[model samples]
Each structure stands twice: as structure tokens, then as C-alpha cells.
Target: QQQKCKQYMSAELKIPTPHSDCKTACILLGQSLKSDLMCQFENHIADFMDGLIEESMILEAAPVSAVFSSSLSDKERGKLRHLHPHSQGKQFISRRSLLDELFEVNHIRTIYHMFIAALILFILSTFVVDFIDEGRLVLDFDLLVYAFGQLPLVVCTWMCMFLSVLLVPYNLFHLWCQSQSSSHGKSRLCSWLFGSVYLIYQTLGLGFLPTYVVVTNSFPPASCFIIILEQVRLMMKTHSFIRENVPRVLTWKKDKNPAPVVPQLSQYLYFLFAPTLIYRDKYPRNPVIRWSYVATKLLQVLGCLFYTYYVFVRLCIPQFRSNSLHLFDLRAMVLCVFNSILPGVLVLLLGFFAFLHCWLNAFAEMLRFADRMFYKDWWNSTSYANYYRTWNVVVHDWLFYYVYRDFLWMSQKHFRTVALLCVFTLSAVVHEYILAVCFGFFYPVLFCLFMCFGLMFNFIVHDQRKGPIWNIFMWTSIFLGQGVIICLYSQEWYARHYCPQKESSFLDFLKPRSWSCQRPLMADS
Candidate 1:
């Protein structure tokens, strides 16, 4: 039987007699036995030989032989099929960002050096001006200090949010899972009751508690930002946990014979702190935590903070400080817009570096999470579409998975455009909400730019326009958009402060004070 199997395998596979082996024949036969092929050849030796002859004839009739198909294109050879965008899988083992690899190149390293040089020049210029104007080189960081004030309260709030996030989701999910496994009616009912109560508690703790603190204490913008950002992070983390695990619990409830797999609390806790937004049972991790690298990233974050302070003080503050509302004509607006471009771009870059790179990398290293792809080469993108998808990959991943992809699935893949619109709308609303909450106002400048101009650009200047000019256009748009946001928001911010209304009303609060800062001519007369 073994000899006959070997002979059949050799003839079917077109292997030479000299190279034919029993082990290979046995493996092939084992596979066949596990499949329907075994049934066709089960009758006799004649049947097996007939099947092999048919297979060989089919192989010979093919246009291209597998052994000599090098002339074929990758598509023809089925080699590049996986390269298709939809064919690619969403989740995989983590890898470093493209910029991290580029930093190893000499040319890319030069760019880093250039940024350092610019920082040094800014420092020197500040010192020289201080010495010349005041006959002293005293450095004041009062703005920076004020921006980051109320640290103890912020820390306490963050700790409270973190504890709630760490404990609530896991415990609720655990209870649900246990209830799913239970056979008794009373136990299941009790579990449901406990879960409902726990969820309400979580809602109040995660949502209302933070907002109450921020509103009651009249937290500064920066301090409010800390609480709001933490709230967002914890909410996202909890949603991800529920999204990933709940279906499994439901599935297990249906099939109660086999035990369900539940991830450990340690794994969930680790995921809460991990840089990536996706939840997983386990993630690729580094063998050792690099303390030096962590320290360097932390320092870079600090440098970025200082960089933002300097840019605002030198470029933004002075531009808006002395300008009266009556003097804010078209010329003033144009000048302010142009002047804001440099500082706005600098702030954008510093923010991208500080949070996406430095802050994420620091946390990733500390946690030994090997995947560090927090961002991509968004600068090189020629379209706003690509820019949105590539920039802030962490958020993009979550939005794509939870919002875009899930919407498509729910809609049975019919409403693709609607799904995309939903994504854009959600993103725009979230951005506007964050800004409104942080700034304590309802300026929808970001919303207008994002939903209107940004959405238009996404379709108009798309990924198909692959040229240097298109890239330049995209960058120009980015600079102008940033300038407009900085200029208009800064102006409104100052206008509110300098020209407070006699009595605060909802209409007055919602109104843009910058537009009506100067009283009516009749009132003045």
C-alpha cells in the first residue's frame, strides 16, 4: 500500500522517481484522507490511478506551469493579491512607525538636527531681546506655569478616572460572563441586577464626576483639558473592552457545554495603559523596558511643552494683545492670519511630536508594548483623505474598526458613502466638542473647517492625484487652516477677556464678541 501510494503521489505531483519519498507520500495521503478526495479513490487501485491521471491531465492543460512561471506578472501569478487594500487584515503583530526607521537614515537625521538648530536659535533670540530691552537676561515662565497650574487636583482627578476605568469595565464584563455560564434562574437574575447597578455607577463615575469637578472648580483651560482627555481615554478604553469581549460572552451563553475563555484582569489592566487603542487578549511586547529611551522621550515631551510656550508668547500673544476691536479690519485680519501661520505650524509640529511620538513612545516603552506605530508619514500625503487616515494612526484605527467598518457590516455593505460620512461627522463633532469644552466657548471654526472644507478637500484632492504640486497644495491648505484657527480663536479668546459683557446672557455667551467689540457709533456719540 505504501509503495502504491508513493507511486501515485509521484505521478500526481510530477516528482521524479529518484526524489520521491514515503514520508511525503504519507503526508499527502493523510491530507487526502481528511478531505473528499479520499472518497473518489477509495474503491480500488484502478480508481486511485484514474484520479491521479485526471489531475495530471488537468495540470498539463493549464496555460502556465507552476514550475516555470517567472514571466507572469505578479497578479497573473497570484503573488500580489494580498497587496490589495481590502484584502489586507486590520489587526496584526505590532511594528514601529515609518518615521522611526527614517530617523536611522542620514538625510532624515539632518531634519532632526535642523529642528534642534531652530530651537537653539529661538532660545538665543529670546535671550538677546531680553538683554537688549531690559538690560537683563531674566527668563520668565509664568505663562507655562499658569497653563499647567492646579497639578495636584488634575492628578487626583486622573487617578480617580483611571481607577474607575480599570475596575468597572472588567468587573462588569466578568459578572456578565459569569451570568452567561450560570444555569440557575435566580443567580442569573441577581447577576443582571448587579451589572445594571454597576453600569449606572460607572456612568456616573466616568462621566458626571469629572465634568462636575471641572465646572464647579472653574478649572483653567489646560487643567480642564487634562480631565477631559483622561475622560475620553477611559471611555474609549471601556468601549473597546466591551466591543471586543461581549460577543464572545453572548456566543458562550448560547453554547454552555464548553467553557468560555476570559482574559485575565492583568491583561485588561495592561491594555488600559497601552498606547494602542485596540483591545486584544495579548499583544507583542519587548523583552526588556529601555529606561534610557523612556527618559529621552519624556525630555522631548518637556522640550515640546517649552516650544509651545515660546511660540505662543512670541508669535501669538503679542499679535492679539494690543489690537483693539475697532482696528480689527480686513488688513488687520490678513496680517494676523499671516503672522499666525508660523506659530501655528510650529505648534502643530510640536504637538505631533510631543503627544503622538514622545508621549506614546514613553508609555509604550514603559509598558514594553512592541508596536509603536502611533503615526505615519502624514507630511508626505498629497491629499487630505490620506492625511486623515495616516495621521494619528491610533485614533484612525479605532475609528476605522468601530465606526467605519462596523457601520458597513451593519448596513450589509450597501451604504459605503453613508458610513464614510458618519465617520467624518463623528470626527468633526468630537473635535469641536473637545475645543468647545476646553476653551469654555462655542466657536465652531474647527467644525466648519473640518466638516466643510476638510470634507470637500477629501473628495476633491484625493489619493489619485499623486504629484508634487498636489502635495504642496495639501500643505498650503494645512498651513492656512491652522493659521485661520489660531488667529480667529485667539482673537475671540482675547475679545471675551478684554470686553466682558455687562450682564452675562445665553445670547451674549454664544455670540462672537470679536465681531462686535466696538460699540455702535450712536452709543459712542
Candidate 2:
């Protein structure tokens, strides 16, 4: 633990003097307690100096940052500017995730308990239904099995993506930074050469390769979705790393350091596993791993998975497996949509809890990645803009910092609305792509919702909306939107399979099969 603190202090504080560095590391690690190392050092000073110790060696009563820079060695002060660079004054402060802190409150923990209780009810209801239908309780996971089919292919494709991302971007940056010491023409030539290669890899290697494997291999929805999601995640991480670090490298190059300082391989490796899209040499981390906390979060994720399965079995399947599945009436479509709201809302909540809350917190705990603010109180958001900002802060931070901020910086901050639109468009496209691959069909319900209604809401309901009514409106919109998503996707999923295309055409793949196809979907027995 002391070693970890020293490492963190070295990378994060960048303190030069051994005395200040060790003292600060100890203070941070032990938090408000006098450090054992400091005590030992003091004792050594007393023995070595024969009770006549020097004043310069002792840690001051003032703040570490104040005394810290005064003790900077000349070599460190000179070389420091060229290393890892980011926004000044911003530093990773070790902190708990919102949910973890919230769970300390009785009311907040009760809400969590409510979700667990719902899971219990779902399990009991599934058993009851099975007992009534089969004359004995039946345990089955046919849907789960089918969804997560083709696991081997998914694993292989993921490894390929991970390896390519792990190697390509960091190596490119390292090589490019090293080449900065060469002649101007040589550096410029190498820049284009390395930049082109990196772009090609990002597009083809990270983007297309895994997608091709997923598409051609006929992986199931769960398998395909995970592979694609991972591909995007890696791509985003690499982008953020490069965007954040490239300027730092250039700044270091300008300093004419004989050896350019790039990020360590260890830092890059940590970023890959850390539950954050942003890249930094170090993050605020915990002193020790809580295995029990990790276990609880993972178990909750598993429970949420089963809860979703039963939701599909009890609510979604029975409704979507319609008697009038062959009908193409507006009335049927409306009923399908309205009937989907409850199940769709449940799925949305379960997904948020499972992935954003449980899964992320589990990984964060294991990694001791202390900045756990993966999301916020999006449920309480009164405005669509606030909701969007708080929904998935991990993603939002990437879009805001890299996409939105960069766009504004490029455009001189005049096109704020345009930047916002760009974020929405990119998010919508990626979302639509995920759904399309998973369900094995092209449906733009979410895309339309994001681009049209979502964007409109963002403008109409700005941060000025603080009333309770606005909150009501936001939730009502969410409920309706969830209904549309589930209903359309469910219908299109069955339609694509039940009414498979005869001969391929451009319109055939683009068009919605549910609108015209006349096959009735059979409910699972």
C-alpha cells in the first residue's frame, strides 16, 4: 500500500524532492495520521546529526503543494513541461461513486432493496406460471441461451479488437513522438506516414474487422452487441488518449528534450481496464480492494440479468407474440406500442442498474478506480438537457470533452448548437447500429427519436425547467419513448425472421418488414 501511494505520488504529484514526496505519499495513504515513514526519518535525523538536525529536511506545517514545488530538483523542473499534459488545476481526487455513497442513506438503500424485491417477485411469478402451465415447476433459460449463443466467436473477435487497440495507438504515438527529434522534413514525412497507418487501423482494424466477423459468423444478438460495443469503446478510448496526449507530446517536443516523454505502458494498460473513457497517466484510486463490494455488485448484475429474462418471458413475449401478428392495421400497431410500455420501461431500468450501476461499480472496485461517478441522478432530472448530461457521464464526458469541446474550439465557440447536434447525431447513429446488429434488422425508431424528438426536447426543455411538472413531463416522455423502442424492435425482430427476404434488394433491406409482411409470430410454449 505504501508502494502504491509512492507510485501514485510520483506520477500524479510529480514532486521532485525525496523528503516531500515520501511525506506527501504517506499523508495521502494514511489520511490525517502521522506517517510511520516520517517518524522513522525524523528518528534517523536525530541519530545522524547527534540531536542537531537541519531545518530544510523537515516537512513544513504548510500545504504540501506550497512546500512541494520549492523542493523541486532542477532536472525535474526543466523536464516536467514535456511530459503528460492536461487542463491545469484539474486533478483526480479519490472519491466514492455516487451510488455507493447514496446507499448509506436508508431511503436510497430502500430503493435498491425495492429492485431486489422485484427480482424475487419475478422469480416467484416465473415459477408459478411454470407450475400452472407444465403441472410442475420448470427451470428453463432458452432465451438466455439463444441470446448469448456463439460465445467462442465473440471471445475471439473481442481479443482481436483489444490487441489491435492495445498495440496500434500507443506505438504510433511513441514512434511519432520519437521522430520529433529528427529533421523538420523527416518529422513531417513520418507524421503523415504514421497518421495514415493509425487512421487505417482505427477504421478497418478496430471498426470493420470485428464487425465483419460478427456479421459473417452469424453471432447471436448478445454476442454481436457485446463485440460491437467493445469495438466502439476501444475506439473511443484510443481517440481520447491521442487527443489528450498528442498536444502534450508536441509541447514536450518544443522543449527540445533529448528524449521525449510519453505515457508509460502501465498507464496505457490501466486506462484500457478502468471504467472511464478519459485518459490520464493516473487516476484517483482506493488504498485497498474490497472483495465483498466487488462480489455484491457482480451478483446484482447477475440478478438484474435474470430479472430482465423473466420480464421478457412474462410481459414482452406474451404481448409481442400476437394473435394478429399478421395484421397490418394502425390499431394493432398502436396497441402493440402501448402494451410494450411497462416491459420496455422495466428493461430500460434494469439495463441502467445492471450495466451503469452494478457492472461498472464491480469493475471499479476490483481496479480500485476511485472516481465512481459513472452516472448521476438522471431519474430526477427536470430538463432533457440535464437528463442527457447525467444519463451516462462516462460517455457524456467523452462526447463533451472530445467531441463537443473540440468542435467549439475549432469553430471558435460560435457553433455551440451545432456541436450539440453533432453529439446527438453520433450518439444516435451508434445506438441505432447496436440495435440493428443485435436484432438483425435496420430500424431507425431510436435514431429518429434521438435526432428529432430528443433534440427538440433538449431545446424546449432547457436547464430553466426546474418545476415538478417538468420532471413529470420528462418521465412521461421516457415511458412513451421506451414503449416505442420495444414495440418497434420487437415487431421488426419477429418480422425479419418470420418473413425472411426471398431475393435481396436495396429497398428490401432498408424497408420495415413488419409494415408489409403477413406472417404471424408464434409465442414460445
Candidate 3:
């Protein structure tokens, strides 16, 4: 009926009816483009339907290939029929449209797998709970706890390996399917980064420490280095096929085509060591990666120098001899702070920046790539929002996909704020666990609570009109709250553990205009 509507519209507006020459073009354009059609026409009911009636919209939409299949003129459909060869009863769907529906639009297989995984987890958890409750799984509490605690890590490792090999290749195939002209340098880049990181970590035994005692009761060489190297070797072979074939499999227009595949392979390798993919889509032309990498290495060297200086001061210099030693008073601690935080943070920040640079560049490339090859408007009007979302998307993707998405799905519309609060709390709890493992203290829980309240408050009651000021206030409150708790908690721990009097009040430290700020000796003293 859309055809009738177009005719009605033409008559009503006194515009000439579409020429015979344009009909084939219109049909091809309509059929080849589905997303743009839906995005443009989803809300318009008049063109779509009426009660108990499906209206014929236009001359049956035909494929682009069908339009160009025959030498016949647009005035003759009968002559073109033999060359076109499409069945009259069948509806045409673009190959891109079919892949999109299966993988992107519907996510049918993903949903099915998730359901199966959830059921298995449920059953296992139930059996474990029952076994523990009945005392049938007999073991000492510590051993049992340690073994059970590893379950999540084991499951995560299994899933990562599965997805790395299976889902990654599947995503690569989608990239191949979508790339009509370009050789999909971006997709290959993503695979390289992931593969490189996986290999590096695996070679390092994922940062695990193992001890082996020799005959002389001396420590054996660290096994972690060997494991990591082995994993890296495996990964190289696993990715060899993609490394060799990607450039040849896809075609590209000459000007738009990438340099010889070797340079492209090198670029992918660069990203593998230090990912450019995250921000590559955002800022492909930027040289921030090289400078950032240099700066990080410089900081690491500086950190090592500081550490050596600290050791020299403590061991070689006399204690309490002179104020001349700036080394012990402040320089040592400054060095310690740098040694504590900078190396890891610098690497993380570099990754974050790379993610931003790559994502925007890739997105821009994607738009141009789609426009030149597909000749369809697949890019969303909310492209800016999408760019922001993809910029440093790895962590947020995990948060949204695993936690927030599931929380929202389960809760529907009810208590969304509460569900979000729980998610924050859960994140905080995991962070606290990590903190406790690294440092022999349970004090990080207070920081976790601080984050929970801050996130919940900002999310539930944020005011857009005062967004900047509101953000400042929220951040200040969280920092101050955490700072106060940490200070008090540390002082309390010190007093209880080392300071003579465990019960001294703050007032006792400031009594009766005492010339000495130090507390008086205890009665027993």
C-alpha cells in the first residue's frame, strides 16, 4: 500500500508520478537497505498497516544485482526476469541483513548459550550448597575454602579461552562479511591486541608465583617466565592463519587500500604489545601512543633509581644523626610512593588513552567505509553518544554486559536505583578483596562503602542543570569521607598495635596547656 500512498501523495501534491526508469532503482534501494528503512519508517503506521490488512507498499523491492542483471530497459520487467532469476514467491534479504539479524540484531545464539550457562551454574551451585550443608564433602575449612574460592577464577579462565578462540574468530568472520571493499585492518588490529595480551600474560603465567625446593633446600628458578613464553608461542601459531590471509581475502579500492600487508602486520603487532585499538577508532592519526610508551619507560627507570636511593640511605646512612639527611625524612617516602603507584598507573593510563584514540578513528573510518561500499545510511544519528560509549569501552563493556545489564534485565523497572547500588557495592567488594590480598589489611571495605554511597547518590539524584558543580560536590564528598575513615582507621590500628596506650582519647593528647604535645607516661610507668 506504500505504492498507493506514494501515488496518493504525488496526486495530492501534484507532483509527477515516478518514471518507469526510477522504479527499478527505487526497488533496489528499498530492498538493499533495511536498517535505514526501519529507522526511518518504524514509527509511521500509515505506510505500514491497517486493521486486519497487510498493504502492498510498492513494486516488489528488488536486489541491486537484479536491477543491473539484464540489458533490458526499465520499461520491460518480462525481459529482465530470466536474467534476474529471483522466485516470485520469495522475499529478498541482503546478505548483510541476514548476518546482522543472526549476530547483531537478534543475538539468538548468544542468548541460547547464556541460558544454558546459567542453568549449569545454578545446578552446580545448588549441589555444592547441599553437599557443604550435609557435611558430605569432608575437608578442613581452609582447604575447602581455598579450593572453592578458585572456582570463579577457573570458570573465568575457561570462558576467556573459549571466547578468545571461538567468539573472536566469529566476530572476525562478521568483520569479513561486513567489509565489502576495505581489507578490515581494524578487525585484524583488534585480534592482534587481544592475542598479544593473552600471550604475554599467559607467558608470565598470568602473574602467579610458584615455589619449588631443590635438594640443597634452595629456591628453583621462577617457573612463571617459562609458562608465559610457552603460551606466547602457542598464540603466534593460533593467529598465524589470520596473519597470513586477511589482506588477500578482502578487496579494497586502490586509494583506500592499506599499505602492503607487512606494514599492517607490524601495526597490529604494535597494538598487540600496547593496544591502539581502544582509541584507534577515535583518533587514528594521533602519534600519542609512541610518546606515551616512551614516557612510561622513563618513569619506570626513574622509579628504579628512587628505589636504589632509598636502599642506599637506609643501609649506608646513620639514623637520627643529622637533619642533613633529606633522604630519610621525605625523599625516601616520595620514592616509595612513586614505586608504589606510577608504573602500573602509567601503563593503565596509556591503555586508556590508546583506547580513546583508536575508537574514534575506527568509528570515523567505519562511517566512511560503510558509505563508500554499502551505499546505505547505517550510522546512527546518535553517533556522538556511541563514540563516547566506545571511547575506553573495555571496562564499561564488562560492567554493563555482565553486571548492570543483567541487573536491569532481572529487576525490570522496579528499584533500578537499588539494583545499581548493589552493582556498585559488588564492585567495591571485589576491589576490597583484591586490596586485602595484596595488603594484609581489611580496611579497604570502608573505601568500598564510600564508593557505594557516592555512586548511588549521584545516579539516583543527579541534577543535569548543575552537572559540573554536582560532580565536583559528589567527588569531594567521596574523597573526604574515604580520607577521614582511612586516617582514623590507621591511627586506631597503630595505637592498638604499637602505641603504648590503646584507650587514649584525642583530648588526652592536648591537655591543660602542656608544653610537651606528647602524652604523659602511663600510671604503671
Best by TM-score: 2
User: Which lDDT tens digits does candidate 1 get at residues 392-488?
Assistant: 8888888877888788789887797898899899989878877877776788999999999999998999777888999999899999999999999
Best by lDDT: 2
Give candidate 3's TM-score: 0.30
What tens-digit string does per-residue lDDT give for candidate 3 at 27-130?
65554454345434743764455411321212233442231122223423332342224332122121221112344545666863563464455445545765
- Candidates ranked by lDDT: 2, 1, 3
Clashes of each: 0, 0, 30
Least well predicted 10-residue stretch by lDDT in candidate 2: 61-70
- What does candidate 2 score on TM? 0.82
| TM-score, one value per model | 0.80, 0.82, 0.30
Compose the digit string of candidate 2's lDDT tens values, residues 1-525: 456546544554433356666667765656423345654566676677852322222223213222111233344333333333333322344555667778999999999898778878888988998899899989979999999998887787788788888888999999898888889899999989999999999899888888888878888888888998998899999998888888887887788766656899889999999999989888878889999989999988888888899999989887867544554778887888889999999999999989998999899989999878787778888989888878897898788778777787899978878887899999999999888776767889999999999999988998878899999999999999999999888888887777788786767767898887786675642
Superposed by TM-score, candidate 1 places the C-alpha of residue 409 at a distance from the truth, in angstroms, of 2.1
Task: Return the lDDT, model 3, position 64.
Answer: 20
User: Where's the lowest-lDDT run of ten residues in candidate 1?
Assistant: 63-72
User: Between which residue pairs do clashes occur in model 2?
Assistant: none
Candidates in order have lDDT scores of 0.77, 0.80, 0.36
